[model samples]
Target: MRTHFCGELNKKNLDQDVTLCGWVNRRRDHGGVIFLDIRDKKGLAQVVINPETIDTFKLAETIRNEFVLKITGKVIARDNEMINNKISTGEIEVLANHIEILNASKPIPFQLDSMETSEEVRLKYRYLDLRREEMQKRLRLRSKVTHFMRDFMDKNDFLDIETPFLTKATPEGARDYLVPSRTHEGGFFALPQSPQLFKQLLMMSGFERYYQIVKCFRDEDLRADRQPEFTQLDVETSFMNEDEITSLMENMIRGLFKDLGDIDLPNEFPTITYHNAIKLYGVDRPDMRIPLQMVDVNEIMEKVEFKVFSGPANSENGRVAALKVPGGASISRKQIDDYTKFVSIYGAKGLAYIKINDDGPSSPIIKFLGDEVTQKVIDLTGAKTGDIIFFGADKSKIVNEALGSLREKLGNDLKLFNKEWAPIWVVDFPMFDEADDGTFNAIHHPFTAPSVSTEALLDNPGKSLSRAYDLVINGSEVGGGSIRIHQSDMQKTVLKLLGIGDEEAREKFGFLLDALDYGCPPHGGIAFGLDRLVMTLSKTESIRDVIAFPKTQTAACLLTDAPSSVSKSQLKELNIKVTLPTKN
Candidate 1:
């Protein structure tokens, strides 16, 4: 329908005729000489209809924002005064010789250039919203990134294999979106939360290497980076260890960055133990770009007279950690109050601080602590003359979360972070953690294999460590994976330790257990969240911007208004009933 794209017109095509079809981005009629900014997916081009072409000029006046049109014109250099330095096609304009109204559009619901529109409104009008330049660029970049990954994997002999979307529900780390079977009456199928199980089965089937850009679903709560349905670059391999797989994936990421641009990524990714990450940063996913780290102050606090600090320090499940905010002595009282409220959202009872003034700890709580205790805090934190320290003391979980999150906040507030990137592998995670009810649950999943040395601890259970690793970038968990137990006995033991009895394990994962018995190869893989990864590479903070279409925080599709009720007949066919919760 068109000979050239809007962005393709330049000085080289100054006298050539071109046919272009796109929407009118803007229209201006200056004393009957009509001008239109024609836009397509590529970019914008100016089309001029002079007074000599009176009929076309009159027709252009009907074209408002978003009116689709096709024009045949001769490209000509724009007068110096009319040149636009912002675009590549800035040097020239097309003088319209022929014009046709391909389609017409009503006034759009929202402006394309405004970033202040509500996400709901933008999503509802997503087709128009995607026409915006930024959205188009982001989607294009995503495509390029996927292409790069695929090429890199293919060159390494990884097969682009697909796994099932509708499969058995094997509790693959998230709640599956189940599909009811009308034919089978009571049977149901589930959307995969990942290709975790199927990818492993592929290894058993003798595929040495595999990769897939696949969609996964989960019936889970939403976060800035999470959605009910998401995409992942699922990968798996047979007979590869932790370091081998990690190095291969790390090299792939570096190659991708280099191919896209000469972006200098670290030659080698750093490694950290899960235990050390929690103790130093208060969170396993710590932002290496941020120089600040948490310091243990429980010993110093235990010696103080302040009960607020001493109480938790003496308790079994409690901890006291401080995040030293560099040059934060000038922080206002209001800012501290704001930070207190921020931590409260994460279930913290209160936020404590000891602002180091010109002399020493100057807060009111400083009076309760003796000189020795105050000096210990300063020494332990390595606090300089201009630093202020914030403390979180509570149960271990609360202390980690509050203090961990405070580090992120202080980085932004005090501007103590660089824009540089850092990727690391957090290895040797606990295989299981005891819940409040004393039941043990898999920290990663039941399928994750424990280190051979820790296989004995499976009998003790509380001390077992898994051969799991997470690829963390700037504190975000971009990907996670583990080596699988190819042996049936080891798999059974690990499942048993996770509180899943043999009978239950057989009922849910009997097929996998049976497969292991038949001689499954030693296998492991990683699944990178495609959305989070692309967003990280693009330096976009919100994952939603990377997705072509994404739902709101409430998990409703504004464009389609999905999850709406269906007819009673539909429910009857699936042998299901819709019930509403009773008002208490």
Candidate 2:
């Protein structure tokens, strides 16, 4: 319908005849002349019609915002004083010789540029929402990101492969979205949480390098960065060890951020052990941008008479830690109370603080903790005048979560960050985590190979570490992976430790076990959460902002009205009966 995009015209094309197709962005009447700003996917262009062109001018007067138009015009330079410096076609405008209205739009539900539009309304009218400049730009950048990744993988000799979406169900932490089979009564196919086993099988099938920009599903609770179904840049390779794989992936991220985001991410990301990450920052995905860190005060608090601090300090699973915020003595009592309420969300009873005022350390709890212990804390945390030391005394997990989360909050609120961008590699994760009942759960997944051998892992499962690594950027776990067990025996041994009996193991993962027996290579790989990656790059808090169409937090698609009921005949064909549950 047009010879050129509305945005593609400029001073270089001045005096040339052009036909453009787009929606009317804005319409105005300037004296006797009519002006319309037309917008397309590329951008907007201003079109002018003079009284001299009586027919076109009259047509322009009828055009309103969002009316689709096809215009044939002569590109002419705008008077230099009249140029709009804000837009791409600001220096020039189209002098309309002819105009055609393709479609007319009624008043929109909300203005395209309105910032106060509710998410519910925006998502419901996602088509109109996508027409906005920000949404179009985000989706376009998302396409470029995927293309860059595909190009990088291809250049690195990674085969872009596909895996089955409808695969067998197996325990992989999250619940699966099941699809019923018509041919076999009661049979179901589960949507993949990932192509975990299938990718491993490909290694056994001898595709040394493989990658896929694939979809994965998980029937789990949603978050700002989670959805029922999500995209990942799935990757796997054989022969290469942890360092080789991590370095290559790091380079990809570094280059992507530098080129696409215009941010110079760290050339060599710092490495931290899983244990140290928890000890220092409380979370596995630590935001190193935050200068705040947790200090172990367990030793100093152990002998104190204050039961709140000493009791947990002496317990095996307990901890007493401090976070020193520089120049935070200015913090008000009300703000401290607010922080106390915040920490309580993580199971902390309260937040304790010692402010280094002009005179000396001051706090109501100062009397309970004697001068000696208080002085030690002041020295350990290097608390000077104008500093405040916040304390968390509870079970280690509670202490870590409360203080760790508080640290990040304070970093943002108090502006304590040392830098804008921080990326790190969290390595040496435990092979398994111990439950309260002394049972074991895979730290990453069942297939993750331990850094130690089968005999060694069996002897000390709690102490065993995995050859796992996670790529964390600014506190988000963008990607994670671990070496896979190549030998069938090792896989079985690890599975047994998790209380999966022999028969159940055979029933659930017999195919994987059977495949492993047939020459599975020593391989490892990571899957990058593409939505979360884009969310970070786009500087958006919610992954949905970057995703074209995302479900709500309740996992419902309001636009499509999905998860709807099936017809009786359809259900009968599948040999299924509806069973509505009774409300409590």
Candidate 3:
């Protein structure tokens, strides 16, 4: 229907006839001459209609924004003052010889380029929202990213494989999105949380290397970086150790940035143990861009008379840590209170601080600690004049969560980032995390191999570490993987340590255990959250912006009005019944 895209016309095509088809971006009538900004996937180009062409000029006068049209015109150089330097085809305009109104649109609910539109309204009209230039560019970049990943994987001899979307549910950290089955009454099929099991099976099936850009679903609370369903670049390989697998994946990611965004990552991403990451930065995925770090002050605080600090310092599960913020001595009382409130959301009782003034140290808690202990803390934390040491004294988990998050907030609020991009590998994660009741849960997954022998892991489950590693960029975990337990005994042992009894393990993952008996290869793999990766590459704050169609934080689709009710007959066919809680 068109010879050239609206954006493809330029001075190089001057005097050449062209036909363009697109939506009318804007229509303006200046005296007798009419101007129509036509837009298509390529981009925008201005079309001019002279009064001498009375029919076409009359039609152009009636056009409005979003009116689909086809224009036959001759590309011409724009007048020196008329050139739009901001756009690609800015140097030229199309002189319209004919205009065809293909379709007309009703007045749109919101302007395509308006920044003030609420996300709810934009989501409701997502088709229109995707037409915006920014949205178009983001989606285009996302396509290019996926394409580059596929090309890279193919070059590495990884076969693109498919995994079943409808499969039996296995424990994968999150609750699965179950699909009711009609063939088997009262039975359900769960959407794959990941192809973790099937991909392993693929390796045992002798594919050796497999990759898939797959969809995964989780019935969980949503956040800016999370969704009900998301895509991941899933990969698995045989006969590769942790180092080889991580090196290859790092090359893929480093090359992705270099090729797609022209951003160069380091030759080797720095690595840290999970314990050190939490101890220093308070989060395993530390934003190395932020220079702030948490210092252990438990030993110093243990001797202080202040029970608030000393109590946690002396307890086994408790911690006393301080974060030194440069030039924060001038922070006002109100700002400190605000910060206290911020940390409180993470279970902190309050945010204590010792401000190192030019005169000397000062704080409300100074009198309780006395001069000797206060000076020791300042010395220990290296809090010089003009620095403020924020303290978190509580259970270790709460302290880490509160202080770690506070460090990130302080970095952004103070503009303290030292670099634009920081990529790091966090490894040596604890195989299991102990629950409050002393029960254990796998840190990664039950299938992840332990760094120690099966007997050692079983003997000291609390201290056992996994072969797992995570790829974190700018404090966001973009990918994670671990070597698999190829032996059935080791897999069962890890599951047993996680408190999954033999019967439950057999019921849930018997297929995997049975497959392991039949020559499972020594393998490892990684799954990169495609949405989060794209969000980082595009420098967007939310993954929703990068996704084509995304649900709200409540997991409702405003556009489709999904999660709607089904008829009683349909429920009966699936042998299901609805029950509602009685209102009090």
Candidate 4:
């Protein structure tokens, strides 16, 4: 209980008596005079306890870092020489008449401001870690982000509606986290991967515009940007086409950036088709900031005698492509080997290159290509004197993955970004990808509407495109959505193409199918990954930094020691039995 925040006092409050309660950030001593820095969410303020107040001085002397304290003092101006220009309260100090230690603290395991602390230790002591100023600022910004989202949605007549967290499991791409039923034996409810179906159902239910800031779960392998559980800004609307929906969503994002970070994103984000994005940049979500692009050398290499390039170039599913890195001829042999190893992780067999030197082209494979063919490659790629052309020759999948990833890595490693913020819309994605066994899988989801009729789609499913679109910022997909197939027959047709039999579809998605029959309107919506958006805005590398309680890379919660066993009696009531895989 204090009259004023410790950091709020400045020279204007000089001679004003105040009661400030906070933790002792630091304790200092000059001769016999004792000084303590009191800190709270606002910031820090220095408190001076002189021997003139004997009891307060004695109490202040015992204070240590993180010691919670309540101070009764007078705000006084600091001497000009004693002024600290770094902090807001620097122009003044609190002359304490009384000091009360609200709580004492043991020595902290790590300093809050230290950068050298391991992420494991920080996560283990997440409560203490969150007390750091940087953590406080980030969480505050997160609150502001949600506030702005809600306000914008409300202004646009979007209803804040909720969907079930414990629901039936449907095929959404990843494994779902299931909750065992106690009342019903052998029954389980899966956590929602997203509110995709429910949101669409809402449109059918006549709630034209619906939105929810919701939690979703997936039992999947973890990465820097992924988590076992994450948040999504789920939205759905009725009677809006793809163009109308994208325009509105773009405005929301543009306003968010300009309002929150004072960063002005483009009014109309550049658009790229899925086919061109893959062919030119090797990835659908291309970082336009990177100037590098993949060049197709299939025709040029197909005639060459070198089997390494000619072999893949001649195959139907194979590709021969080159990435021309400007001024990359200066890279050393060891660095080139390192890049080759990097691409190998993406199933690339090897990386080949031809460096354009001032004297002419040079490479180990130049002898294989011959002088005539080598010159053709140089001319085809428009290779300059100082440039290096890195080639990928393999199945199209491997080539795209290897070269796409390498493009991003080189962009960062070589500082080749052409702009700071590059947002683009990747559209016209193929409706389905055919497996080796000839079965089809939906590229986005089965519910996504195809651009062609059901019969047309069935005729050539591989070439059919979806109305789906994704919003990408700096190569990270922030949001994605597509027009929905409101017709029940169309929905079932797409499901059929995905190898889902009628009985299986009825068992899993009967509710959605049944709802679609009841006069559903033309509708579509987008879901933004809230954690990824904040991570991008805050310029943090990992989603964990933005989350309050995040699991480790292995998806274990260090703080709670979660995924622990329950009592035997509790398991018996749930009718569950434990099973463990034998170690090799």
The TM-score leader among the candidates is: 3
| lDDT agreement with native, every candidate | 0.87, 0.93, 0.94, 0.93
TM-score, structure 2 vs. true: 0.98
List the lowest-lDDT window of 10 residues for candidate 3: 492-501
In candidate 2, how many Å is residue 467 off? Answer: 0.9
Scored by lDDT, the top model is 3
Candidate 2 residue lDDT tens string, 238-278: 99999999999999999889879899987798999999999
What's the C-alpha lDDT at position 568 in model 3?
96
Worst 10 residues of 1 by lDDT: 452-461
**In candidate 2, where is summed lDDT lowest over 10 consecutive residues?**
55-64
Error of 3 at 311 (Å): 0.9
Write model 3 residue lDDT over 178-274, tens digit each, in one string.
Answer: 9999998888999999999999999999999999999999999889999999999999999999999999999999999999899999999999999
TM-score for all models, in order of appearance: 0.97, 0.98, 0.98, 0.98
Candidate no. 4 TM-score:
0.98
Model 4, stretches more than 4 Å misplaced?
none
Question: Model 2: how far is 266 from its true place, Å?
Answer: 2.6
Give candidate 1 misplaced runs (Cα > 4 Å). Answer: 453-455, 582-584
